[model samples]
Target chain A: MNPFAQKKIFLEALQALRLKKKPKETATKTDASVCPSCKESFSKNALEKSLFVCPDCGHHFSISAQTRLDMLLDAKSVRFLNRRLQGGNPLNFPSYEAKLAALRSETGIYEAVVTAVGKIGGVKVVVCVLDSRFLMGSMGTAVGEKITRAVEYATHARLPIIIFSASGGARMQEGILSLFQMAKTAAALERHADAGLLYISFLTHPTTGGVTASFASLGDVILAEPRALIGFAGPRVIEQTIRQTLPDGFQRSEYLLEHGFVDAIIPRGEMREAISRLLALHGRTTA
Target chain B: MTTPKPRTAADRVALARNPLRPSVTDYIDHLFTGFFELCGDRRQAEDASILGGLAFYKGTPVTVIGHRKGKTLEENLRMNFGMSSPEGYRKAQRLMRQAEKFKRPIITFIDTPGAYPGIEAEARGQGEAIASCLALMSRLTVPTIAVVTGEGGSGGALALGVADRIFMLENAVFSVLSPEGFATILWKDASRSQEAAEIMRLTAQDLLTLGVIDGIIHEPPNGAHEEPASVYLALDAVLTRELSVLCAQSGDALRKSRYKKLRAIGNRKEAL
Candidate 1:
């Protein structure tokens, strides 16, 4: 073929590929009932009923920390801990205080992780859930202190500890103090483990960075919600660093399970029962 | 690479990141002997970015840990440009624990832009690893010395920096964040790093004035790269003097001194 003709053919193929990729994205945007993953449409009521998991493809949707607490804990059994503490900007980074205040007002939460003593399947446990909605669940001083205290509390009460993790890693606004939490929380977890207490960590959608590396990975029985993204570096950054395409379903819950990083991949609906079973298996009595 | 006079913090930062600068291996080769490298975090893969092992500093057994930035582009890629992951910090922790068990002193070299910021790093708990290192170092029974050879950036630097004594090369820069990061976060433009560098007080002199570093090892006018032998000698003399003084103290006394030293920092002027 002539050079111009060859160039024209390549351009047309590129255009065709671009055209093929747009519809799924536009479809999700156009219809509120459609899921971005699997490109399947469902009624709003159906999605709400399924706990936002795609009925067809098992795509787990992100839920608020409160929703997770409600889903896992027994009816009206949660007693919040460390509710009065707030993060102070020790580094005095600009806009951090205001951003935190805005997030506080918007999320109605003082910090990212919520620690509570709650009942799961009538079993008493200290529960902590990280809300990704607040500051992408980036850990700071308050989050670290809250988690450490919760673990210590669990250790003291001789109760099983369960934490649901979803985070973007450490908060940059807090500087070194933000990174310090990673150590503090892990150290507390170590002390908790030393007391022979059972700790279960649930890796939710998009658990990455410092949160994944610490207490989340330190769980005696690590569980992940189906299709949740879990890794240290994000896929994009990894791709850029290595200059290669990652394998299919890389860093997903299934992939982690295969690599021995995760024990099981349970669906959102199964989480309550699965956790209950694990707690019971660990000899925690459920009355 | 020939370094300029480095009057400004940005200039010092450039010198710190210069490819020709003398690194951890160079110091180990010149100042220590019978160096045997130990690898792995025991829980994961060995991290090449952190060079850690047992070595003899002037016939005194010590655990040496330092960030390793590669000299070549290919090496840099392999070493992640000395930006450690959780594994690196864990490996350091393992070595520190070993040092504690053997009653050996610990010496660390700080020379990295920062810890690796990737999803995998986060997922593996980068913050937790660094944090554990800080806690471990703070409570360690052995005498510890940290040398800021170049860019001691962020918590990654502080992870290895909790010690009885901390020294910085005259041209080194240490801070809570990089100049570019500070500029981007504060001014909304990374190009304003020169301005940010001025305001952050991250240079060796600034750190000394602010009581962040115990002392400054004066580098040659052309920098450590151009005068490796002299730089090695200066570092050796200080290490010997400090180690001798530190070794004389009892373990409990050493721990108390370290705690006091760390706590006393950032409170110098306020107390005055």
Candidate 2:
């Protein structure tokens, strides 16, 4: 079976485990998520305490952008930027707008990325975090513009920037115009780099394609979450192109770090601390 | 000439990929003089897929780089059928730096399906190389122009195409991915590419309308392959006029205007 197909079964099994672990008192369906790795079930409150990392097996369950913001920034210090920006159906692809609307109401997010600026270890930084549940965190026009604007905000603000990327790639519904977003975001980053500002890219599970080939790779320091799949092409695409089943653990974060593409593989529990420590070292640039 | 009728997106796709279509090698002898070929990324082996060198266009020195897709099967394998690898982009980056250092205008011809998707490419940082090229191309101080001669597939094409002025031939197509890939990914049906192509808005005219390109260079009826001379003449005139106009601007002005062009794409509404 394909790795992803196997993952589907594990996901179903994990859901069943979540139900079983729910306590009789105040045990709601939304109150627990089971780890697919260790098959260990934990209450949502417990998972929040662990920063969504499974304490038993150390598997990182992907977190939402809101959770990420709260984890990275100080409580009540989070100030969102460009939350009103959304994408129209430029290509007029059938049902794309309707799909976006459905995802919006379901996810309670305006777009795939949440651009914000807040204190991390008491030092302000701009961030654009992608949540995969919403359209697999694709880089559509809105996502690109938000990231570009955030980077631009950082350049002028002289603040550090961080992006937690977990995208499937560029959105297909927007067609060719979706591709231009790559160029747009990268240009903003180029200008930011020209200004000698610090930009950190944190790659999460299954970041690939346009996202991988653009800003995610342009970071001055590129970091990935443990076991995250990071590459330009998806593993299935690679296997189909080469007509071979990939070796175990191919395209994982360990493979990338070993190849020198990633600076380090950071686990979820330590991500905020790691980012803040790096920020402390770089400091704020005067120029 | 027959009355020009609109071509279907799939028709343009086939026409752009027509093996008989004129490649970069066909245009060089017709457009430039004293072409001296440069090689290597300086960090690794030289990439044949990306052909970069110094040349004199209309007696003015300039840097010329292109994704060289070979015509024949054996030649295609030799050039990886214009599917550039990490080294190919690095090679382009080196050439771009050289062009900036010497104050020469940078012109690139894009005609790649996309970056080479293979295990080795993944191991060597294909994403990093393509990203580096995109970032560097955006900031180059010299006047930079890119023309899509054929397939401008995804980041591989965009890596070479971030320029002050971008254009495409009448029949060329540029997109986020091939329609086949799109269909397969979206609908799990590769055979529906013709349907996918219809909505992709990848044709040159579509790109021009969307403001993804500055303009479209007209090709001869029945495609540029049938009669190459007219296409060359038209492209030559466009380049000569654009190169002269861009070259006259100061470095700061060129950089500012180019940055504006990059920022302006997909910004037609506040919604995006």
Worst 10 residues of 2 chain B by lDDT: B263-272
Per-prediction TM-score: 0.75, 0.93
Residues A1-287 of candidate 1 have per-residue lDDT tens digits of 24344333323333443354321221223335767789988864455445567768878778777767766777668999988677676555668789989988998788998999999778899999999999888877788778888998999999999999999776666544555466456657765776899989899988876676566777888898888888766676577666778778888888778766778988776777788889889884667
lDDT of each: 0.78, 0.87
Worst 10 residues of 1 chain A by lDDT: A22-31
Best by TM-score: 2
Off by over 4 Å in 1: A1-34, A39-45, A284-287, B1-9, B39-48, B72-80, B83-94, B114-145, B153-272
How accurate locally is residue B247 in candidate 2, as Cα lDDT from 0 to 100? Answer: 89
Question: In angstroms, how far off is A215's CA in candidate 1?
Answer: 3.1
Task: In candidate 2, list every pair of residues with a backbone clash.
Answer: none
DockQ by candidate, in order: 0.16, 0.72
DockQ of model 1, rounded to 2 decimals: 0.16
Q: Model 2, which residues run further than 4 Å from truth?
A: A1-32, A284-287, B1-5
